[model samples]
Target: MDDTQTMHAMGIDDAYHVEQVLARGPRGVTELVTIDGVGPFVRKKIPTVLAQRGVWSALGGSTCPRLPRVEATYELPDCVAVVLDYIPGLTLEQAVAERGRLQQNEAVSLAQQICEAVQELHRLGILHRDLTPANIIVADDGAHIIDLGIARPFTNTANRNRDTTALGTYGFASPEQYGFAPTDVRSDIFSLGRILGFMLTGIYPDDASYATLLADDPNITPRLRAVVERASAFEPSARYQSVQQFAQALTAPSDPVDPVVPAPVSMLGASNGGIRTRAIIIAAIAGIVIVALVAAMTLIPRWVANGDAEGTAANGTSQNAGPQPNTSPDDNDDDMVPSPDSSTQDSEDDDATRGDAAYDNPLELVETGWSADESGLVHYAFGLRNTSDSVCIQFPSVEITGRSEDGSVLFSHTQALMVAFPGETTYFGSQAGNSNGTVPATVDFTILEPEDYNYVNSGESASFKVDNLNAAPDGYGGEIFSGDIFVTKDSERVREQSSQLNVSLVLRDDAGAIIYGYTTFVDWPPEGGSRPFSMDVFDPPAYDSFEVYAQPW
Candidate 1:
């Protein structure tokens, strides 16, 4: 194929011609080329040395939207090359270098979108072995997850069980990815979290060791820090179960409060006058409670504005105060957001009045599949019912969080919705318009972190009304749809059971070939309960299909 000057042996079509080299990597070089009628294109040629690496199949099944569109595949005598759509965007590495660290909100948004893209791939049973900033592209409109040459599908084969020669960018690879065991979705989450840490602090945590990063970044909020710390956990199981969970944890709102306790005169070692000490103690306690309440009021507004589910209301407004800051120099402040532990306080209050209420409600949820158009956006819908008459469901909010396979939170948002009456269902979906504001459907969140890729979250959900005419087929050969949902409740009754709902429609042709399909997930009952569930749809081919297979990374 290399010897042919025009239209070579790899079955080179006249439609495309090589232009120039864009970037070179260990596996191959990506080239800028022109398709006869299709404008700019990218052609990636796998080197002879890496020809045996089954990347073609990996790219085919990958759901990463940021990845270059796979136009066609070719098998050359000496090498293999795949043609793809040329994307116009800058590498994330460049964006960070130029802009320094991104603003917290911007970073979170970008990370969340990336996570959703990755989640799409993971849901299809694929994994991107190599994940790094250099492989990610950030466009003016949104970020793109590129470079899947080392990706592989999760099949029940020996290859999926064994470790490979550690293949990926060093700083971005998880410890377990280095031949410790076969890499899983969580492995990607670990790498994604590391990338996020680098994006936020400009320091690679895995390279310097997470402990070092924690010791150095004093400004890092505790909640954010906790996310990094958890993502960087040595053991894969210790990390988040999914990328959505990680994103939710990272984006969950927080408020600052003081930590001080008054000591009685007797406890203070017999002061000169017990009366004076008592007065001082009483004043201190009063001051602390009043100050805490005041801080709670100020912080709650910002927290709610950011769309976090943790904020609560007392009387009529949000009264939940965030965690107290640790004053120690070694404490990483950014990682220090209020823990979910505080949410129990509200539950305790609810438990006290359980018997007096007219009825008790067990949390339940229902969800529908997601749909998407040609532009590759996703949409989802869900139905929720307040089953109990006793518990006056006040401010109940739903949060949808996405995670990478490695359990890093990519994106999360607490959507506001009109309250649902008992036994009533509400419908919602992705925001209106495309990236250019043309299409009426678009995924609600954008993932900025690496872990945001290839993950899902529960609690928040999307609502939808059935459309029999638009329904698609289900299974492996069917088409798919995608979108999001918005859920909300008042702050008073926040802790409730969460639910996961899957929506899928199947289509079949006259020959019984799965023509089109749609599938998505929504977790409602929004808060606590139930283990994570996976969403998958597959159909076997009628005949032995000549499919591409790759060595697992």
Candidate 2:
């Protein structure tokens, strides 16, 4: 296909002056072009049959530094032209071929940058279905991501289907990219792992001459190899759930249980002697909780009947109590309980809240931060890790205060926390409306030992399964979703109340901040079956991703 003829047919010659022909072949025309005032961009004239290049318009003026901003896109009779800001750098493929293999630290550095760029793509609801060394440009700052020719919008579904075309570079592509399953963030992570390996070895993982991990690979670091192995796990669930997580694993310090063994910076550090240590600690915690819970259960009935217990949880108080407030808000946790990973280390791989004021305190504030919506309703979401060996902070309340530059309080309120079991972590979230559309300069958290908030050290059942989730834009431009919920297991409860299901949703923006929160209810399904649920969030804000939580009230 001649580039001049294609431009002439579309009348693009009138608006875009073709300065140079960059490449023209079966892949169609890609050229450097200039406009009346603006100049120098790579315009890709892709045939409609190849891709609906009009989708590139969404990337115009991309805020991500690693992405070549799409300046404009045009739809022609038989082709769509995408004009992107020209990035001046060698593609990683060219660099590797010209200069040989990259250093280990250099490879890790570039991988981190690529990870960040992919994270931005994910935030934009786009998946770079094909992330290869040839598509990444090695610039001064780091790597720049290009060629969204095979990108697709992110759609999370438990019943995911295969990619129709299965398009990707053989060596760098994830198995799912070859139609094994729908590619998501993990697919990009997989390619990243392959790129790291390629950069160090000068050969793809699929190459016939590829080096055996240990035998021929002496240049790769111990911990980095472990990171790559997990990042390139055959199972998507086994890989890092998000790029942020992958980066953490890459940068976190490694410890060897024994000098001869390499430690994996995993969610539970499940490697070498660490897994055994983790398992033993977990077992000890579980056994202690079970014994204490059994004792509490046996005595509760008799105590209630004989009036030997506190009159009501509302009148109870913690020994760490402050001046009791005359009245306290009802425990909002009854509305939504966060069931994060069972591991106390946190699924986010957050451990900063430990080892300082952590072990000494029963309830350690794992992480605290705040975000706001377009309307400026400040929302605070924080994680609380219960370090206690035999206690569950039932309805633990916290005083949240937003402050300004001078430390003047802007808004103050209390939110009840959920049940963080012994050595387990729970989360709390709350929102406050601001009159002037101004967010807080900073947010602070304070534990409140209110007289009324429930504090139970007893055990209860906590089993739930929410899957096959699907989201769609309501014709009116709002977001709606549906999914299935199952009561995988039941817990023993007191005779005073019946178990009820409460479903909570946390819609997050690209930065992983909560933009919206909503709660709903669903009926229990028949024994061994699941119940379907549909929910609509009113005044729903725009979000790229979301997390769901289900629990009993």
Candidate 3:
């Protein structure tokens, strides 16, 4: 591969024969090139800004199954030329024109593939701001996402208030991509929603008849239609938070009660489990009268004491905010984002400690931010580092409060968090698209400590390790670390539940100072077997080295 990487040293015209001119526009010219010894590849000449060079360099090193691999990249004064493996297939746009719109199951299948691809891009910190049928190719291997001409990395700075560039393809770009709000992982999700709708309605989102056509289509399931509606909501926060979530929704069980709810369970996401409303409904109906009386008795005095507590509804911000680390001089200069925690579970006041370490409110807020847009949309995200040496505890949920000028709790929501193992950082909070847009005068985060939990001892310290670890470029000039987790415990001795591991990436500089972090849930290794995993960090402060934190999920 190093020998092939040197191909970029030669000029494009000198290295391969230009077989055909495929596209020409502001994204630059696209041509099919054929090498005598090699095969056909798509070469794109993309005009670059100071900000785009890093993205091009990263793309040159990125690798994903559903995305076309970049063979080489050449940078010029004005544009960067990228050579991508060419796959023969029709674009989804053309596929729809030839065959009629897809059925529910067909669209769902393809949508899942696209979601998987987009989720990977987001994981690499690249947002495919433009997602439409035309950018997807239907090939033998399945759907391949093409065209990163308009792709951009997630902003690595704290000043990312909005997508400064208001350029996105019409009909599919999220409102945030139009500079309404800052574009993040959710922006791509909005576009995928538009693509899903196009698959069923055969009409672009910008079309006047598109909405009615999609809603009135008898073939499209009401359940599927709801997915499209939520995905394309004008508010960025209203959309599925991540593609993994969107994909889960596409294949959700038809029965409302049985649906695998798209809850934000981790950095990458988890698929199983949901709230059983039947029991809740029965309990609610039976206790309404008593509950109302209880509420009246408990609320009146508390409401008086906590002036803005419930009244924060009018002064509150949005519900779910995407992750954007707010770094300050005193904080570690690392670019990170928050990820969701676990699903519903019971909590008890059981003080759990690990191997001589006592829990003393171990959470340290390393990064924080709160912002709102003119559209009344609000977003807030913060990174938390567990300072304890070996203590790992449950932060089942996080309470973020929006306070009034006098520092009174206006309103707050129980935000999710990625399980942060000892000495690692995880993000908390989500974007709320339909927020009141009121920027809180003061924001407070309260980590609700779990009541009871399990604690592992030091004897199992060497329970797992990465094998054949490999590091590659993540396209935005960052690095991707991948390896297989080999469990040291004997397969016969370990229970299946004990193999569920939560892994987090820790990137540090040459001097070993922390820079970036991310946490994800790994698939259970087969009864103490091994499973592969990768960590994508976009534009970390330094890429000198990395560390992986693995513990029971």
lDDT per residue as tens, model 2, 286-351: 211111111111111110011113221111110111122212233222222322322243223232
Across residues 28-110, which tens digit of lDDT does each residue of candidate 3 receive? 56899888867789988765542366555666556778888888777655456788899899999899988877887888889
- In candidate 1, residue 341 scores what lDDT? 34
Each model's RMSD to truth, in Å? 24.3, 24.2, 17.6
lDDT ranking of the models: 2, 3, 1
Return the candidate ranking by TM-score, descending: 3, 2, 1
Q: What lDDT is reached at residue 455 by model 3?
A: 24
Candidates' C-alpha lDDT? 0.43, 0.55, 0.55
lDDT of predicted model 3: 0.55
lDDT of 1 at 310: 26
Clashes of 1: 91
Task: Give the per-residue lDDT digits (tens) of candidate 1, residues 78-119.
Answer: 457787876788888788878776666677787887787677
Worst 10 residues of 3 by lDDT: 295-304
Candidate 1 or 2, higher lDDT? 2
Candidate 3 regions with alpha-carbon error over 4 angstroms = 1-13, 60-62, 254-553
